[model samples]
Target chain A: MKTENNRAWFLVLPVFALVAFSAIVPLMTVVNYSVQDIFGPDDRVFVGAEWYREILQDDRLQQGLLRQFVFSFAILLIEIPLGIAVALAMPRRGRLASLTLVVLALPLLIPWNVVGTIWQIFGRADIGLGGVLVTALGVDYNYAANPFDAWATVLVMDVWHWTSLVALLCFSGLKAIPDAYYQAAKIDGASAWAVFRFVQLPKLKNVLLIAVLLRFMDSFMIYSEPFVLTGGGPGNSTTFLSQTLARLAVGQFDLGPAAAFSLIYFLIILLFCWLFYTTMMQLGRGSQQ
Target chain B: MARIELAHLAHSYLGKPAEEGDYALRPTSHVWEDGVAYALLGPSGCGKTTLLNIMSGLLRPTSGRVLFDGRDVTDLPTEDRNIAQVFQFPVVYDTMSVFDNLAFPLRNRKTPEAEIRSRIEEVAEILDLASCLRQRAGTLASDARQKISMGRGLVRTDVSAILFDEPLTVIDPHLKNSLRRKLGEVHRESRLTLIYVTHDQTEALTFADRVVVMHEGEIVQADTPQALFERPAHTFVGHFVGSPGMNFLSCEVDGGCAVVDGRRIRLADDTAMDGAKQGDRWELGVRPMFLELVFERPTEGVPVRITHVEDLGSSKIVTATTGGGNLKVRVGGEEEIRDGSAWVVFPPEQSLLYRNSRLCGKSAAGQP
Candidate 1:
């Protein structure tokens, strides 16, 4: 039964090389920048952990981190259940089923920048459809002036754009369920809610986990849509880690702090992603036992 | 338990049924007695599963009514049918423990927790899934998962009937036999109205009290297993219900006899051949087990050229060419016979005559 192990490494070598080239090299560069101070094009100085201390102490970074967490959390909370519900509503067969899926995927296909631009114009109080409708309905809606309005608009846009991915994943999971399960449920006299709770929800766990992690990471690293829409403004209300990193790197021309911030941002995303992955894996294993 | 009666049940996937060909399940009427096991037996696309689904209320029949205990439930949804169904593939909740999967229906009905526990345990015990109760269903082996699916159907005691749609297809051969026997035992002990749907003749014959043979959306015959074997109402039933299937030879009726390949074979009853005329196309059907090899030509026997011989454990199958087609003869013991010279004695009594693919009558007597 023993087999040769010579080919085992061959399969993984390419992936390893790719990851090293794309991720590791840049990560090392960021780490190098974080530990030093860049004075100018040709000048530099060693400053051990100074940028870390500065980032850790700055209230703006803390606020941006908190805002990023809230945004990711809120997106996950809204999208996961809503996506599943939409998936459940989708037809399992026929022409309409595919048509509905294509329609749901349309928002995800739009470029992120375009999505932000479209939402920015669409939510305007004067000429935008959303703003005009809201104003006509007697509600004061202004994304440019109010921080809460800006945040709400950004969150809504994110939900509208990204919930489709979750729904599509859930739809595939739902479609993969053999008709036998539903028949068994019916034979068991299961109520509609019972079937959903016991059969559909449980079956959709893996897909839902993927959806949750993807949405959370994307929302946490959100930069383009909010940047193009609100420019992180009215205040730092819509400012996420990515936007903050970009401002530090591009607007202020502080490469050292910006690199440090980028590394911190990468680590935070990596940390949360690991947490999500581990939690999902543990839940999966626990259920299997 | 409830007796199911199908009153002219017919279904058509097409919106409008302009003709008989449009129906997926043709209008049929039959009654399945409470506490009796029945199998809807047919080949693929024969509408057997469709009938089972209709009976389970998974699909509503376009025409006619379904009655449970004489109560009309034609318009009822599957959830309202009070029937348990085990589908072809295993369908356990992948994320739930086997225990929870088995307890789902009971919990849905708000059954007591203690009752649910005992029922799940009992069903799992019957299905040999007692050791895997805590394991997630998706983690189990395919056969074990299938057992859990069956257990889910069996856990509920208040169901009016249990419908099985080829439930043992994924199980190992040994397990298939044992489960079939177990199902038969369960049916006897509980007196549950069970409708099993399968294309496998052995499973249908061994597990069900009665077999309803279907062909192309029509029920050809519905009778006890013994009757279905002894007197198949249609030629399709005779051909479909046997292991090797009945060997058919096209013939023409000639004066109270059927002449095949220019050889005359007497019919069992002259009255049964009243409508048969010369030159009319007919078929002579006979089971392989009934055909006897004769060393010398008998007074009234058709000649056959032996083509091949198969050594089965308990019996030997002899393949012969008669009338330009292959026919098989099942014989017990080691009978030495040359391939090209062996001839078969078609005992007139053991043969069946068919007109227009419908069995006219059985022939008089032959080797059993």
Candidate 2:
């Protein structure tokens, strides 16, 4: 006969309880609300997948999804390479490196709504330095009236606000590489480009994966910055998934469809994050052969 | 092939070196012949790696010039100097395949694809890496990675010299000898100037045609292995070269005779003691292998009290005490000796004399 001692499980009971109270209960409530139609606080009717079907067919949700995809993709395309370039150009050592690092991290520490408000005033053609400069160059740039200008202003604002996070990640990755690799590269007569391609790029793969994933998720669920700056802008042109979800759940008070929409939004983010992680990891491993 | 020369080479890691101790390498000059294998032998922190790095153009000497085949290349970059160095730890491009790692230099020079393939195959076969040509370099064992690093150097035929900076430091003890011999064979076939730096006397003796012994950032002596064993130029070399090294005893010289413990020993016929100078420091050195032990007392032999006998499989080491200091003697086979009394005799030809730690032009004597 074998005797098993399970006393170790008591140590993990607190963590399980914390998760149940904080996350599981609230998520279950959302799930419950997704399958019911509430006419009043007490008069609720059961609906089976009707709100899900309505959400899947809504044209506004489709447009919002398209906008979300474009915003996330554009952010990744601009920020990843620009951040790597910034990291590479950074001073490797000395007092100047720390000083530059502190400056680069300043924008990241600002609150999200403050960032949007700052950009909102900064993009006004009447006052801000950037706007003044653009006007001095004789360009018609009104972010309020033109949809294209509004989109451009929001894109530039995000780039300025979040590129430092990616840059800091890449900087640490670059620092992790040993000096022997550079010495060996010099002995091998590797050109600058070849050294970057073969040595630096391969070593940065994991950190770049993290940066991309973070940027993608954050940009896809973006709500606060654009909400304060453009308020879904000029004719819903900049309206993304999170903003649309907020409008349905808070402004319209359509409980069933809003809950169902939130679940779909959650699933979309989960699926994309999974796809990004697996594809990047597979690429890293497949190169071993 | 290149005949490398170091002219008044000196280096200081400090920006402004003030004292003698500030410099890592003191002023020195040496010429390594074309296609000859040499080794820089020293203990740790003895400037052996510093000299090798200077030769490979990885470092610039604070004062002096490096010449390759009569061309001054002191300021040349490493790749332009056409030198390859295998470091203490193997440095392989982790993401590249074994084949690509071996072909990197040739590819950098824009060699044709067919030539690159052939060269990679040749080096891979020589290093016994043909079976792992397609395997990723980072996945190999440490020894295999070191071999790949060495193979990268060997694949470039146009190289003027190949430098090894303690390349076998990370290799297993069982594999060290065979890999050393492989490097030796590679040097022979390529006929390139090969300079190996190591602290191990066995590796220095086995791999190099001539060994340069360094101490305290200066070259003490550069000679053939046999000559280095028979005649060490400095007291440090005498104490550093052989197994158990040479035993040194302080002595006084007067009127062509050496005296230890108030007993006079005759100097050899060709030994010189030009001046009967008094109060000069002198030492007599004799290898442990040259000392003979006799059970019975002789007319003119130093009597010793035996302390211990260590059995080392094929040979035994006898530790004894003389009036002046302790002495170790290497004896063959399992000699039966008790820890009581013994007589030891030194052969005249095998004994050397030193003045102020430098080898003097003289020899000590034994009883006729």
Candidate 3:
């Protein structure tokens, strides 16, 4: 027979109550606003999902959602593999390894708005070093007036700023693998690619899952860098879901539909995160059998 | 299938090693006959792993040539050495099934698919891993995983040799015996050259026919396990090979006798007699199991006061003292041993003489 330990629940009551007070209250208020037509603080009418229906049908918000998905997908495609390659190439021990780790962490330490501002000035066609070099190389390189160029600049800026976070996470993952695995792989006569596929990759699953979650959430909800850099671009080509939500809520002063749009945006991130987590967990379970 | 000859092999971790003390493995030339089982036995940090790694092609010797079947292979990497090695810690590709884990080396070597199937199944069966062939390798208990580590080696028929570096270090005591016996069976059935490295004397003596004892980065003695037990060439071997170890007593030279603990121990031959009379000093070596303890005051034995008798289930270890120190004597449990005065007899056949920590006297059990 097992003894009961229900007394431990009292110790966890504070954290649970704190989460309810801080998160649940604000979230319920957002839910309340999402369903009603708000004229003032006390003057409200029960619209019953009208804002949800209207927000979902709006072409501008739909375009923003599509652009948001593509941007996040491109970020995952470019950063994950490049980060792993950089981590693998870095030294694994001694003074050089420490120096490399410190260097890799530098880009991640820069605040988002500062990174956006630096890239903004750096992309000017006249005085910016990068823009002048590209212009000298004989290409149309104006980011402020061209939608395609603004999109490219924002993508490049995000890659430059955030790829190191993935690399640092992966470097720690690689360090966790013991030397015996490499020795056994050598004794097994495995090729270089085979070692990565069978040994290193399998050992890095947990870290990769964490990296994917963090990067996915960060990129899907991204706003500050693009807001500071492109400001939704020349034609709305770079207007992502968060920028569209900000336009409705703060810029245009449309509160009800904006609340409904923000809730839908939160749900999209939640759904994708659940899918990624379940898929990874299922892969882990499949390997155990 | 192939003889291994290590020609003047030496290794040093330092760049430009200037002295003999810098070497991890001192310079030595040795040969391992084909299809013979040998164990390199030593305490930790005694160059056992260094020598094994050199032979396995994992580490290059600082100065030497390694020849397999008279073909020079000192420059080859571990992949081309065609030798199998099981590590101290077991390694298995987690996502792979036990069958695939066994087939990995075979597939890398480009063996025929038909051959791979039969070979993996056969090796897996031999390792008693047939039931879990389809299960993931990482899902098994450690002993099973260790068996998979060895099975990967067994699946390859073209390997010149198989090396095990303390393969049973992580195994439970009850299972260690079965694994060792299985290894012995595998060696007999396959007739493959096996070089096992270990620090445990019992494991070395029981697993291999020939035990190579190393001390301080050099091979001090390489001989039959029986010979190692009967007559150890170095004092370290004498102290390390047996439980409670062999006893040593300093001797004073006298006419035709070496007096130790105020008693005369007969000299074996004139070679030992010359050393007893002229050498700086001589010491008599005898195993506790070989030292007979008599109950009475015998005229022909060394006098000792019986301090204690330890009754181990099957045998009794009698501790006696004569010259300000203890002397251990092992006798059968049925043997009558009481407290107080006793006599210890050293047979000329079993008593060996050592000078400078090395065997100097000619004993009956000297190497043939």
Report per-candidate DockQ: 0.64, 0.54, 0.65
* Candidate whose lDDT is highest: 3
**lDDT minimum window of 10 residues, candidate 3 chain B:** B359-368
Query: How many clashes (backbone atoms < 3 Å, residues ≥3 apart in a chain or on different chains) does model 2 have?
Result: 0
Across residues A34-61, which tens digit of lDDT does each residue of candidate 1 receive?
Answer: 8888777688899998998888888889
Candidate 1 chain B weakest lDDT stretch, 10 residues: B359-368
DockQ of 2: 0.54
| Candidate 2 structure quality by residue, lDDT tens digits, B1-368 | 78998899999999999999999999989888989888889999999988988988878999999999999999998879888888888888777888999898789988898988998888887778999998888788998999888888888888888888898998899788888888888888878888899999999999999899999999888888987788787888888899989888888876666677776656563455665357668887778888898889876667889998888888888999987688899898677777889988877777677777767764322100
iRMSD, all candidates: 2.0, 1.8, 1.6
lDDT winner, 2 or 3: 3
**Reference-based lDDT, residue B115, model 2:** 89
Docking class of 1: medium
For candidate 3, lDDT tens digit of each residue in A1-289? 7858679889999999999999988888889989998889899999998999999999998999899999999998999898888888999999999999898888888898999889898998999988898899999998899998999999999999988988888899999999888888888999999999999888888888888888899999999899999898888988888998998999998888988998999899999999889998778657543
Docking class of 2: medium
Model 2 chain B — which ten-residue stretch has the worst lDDT?
A: B359-368
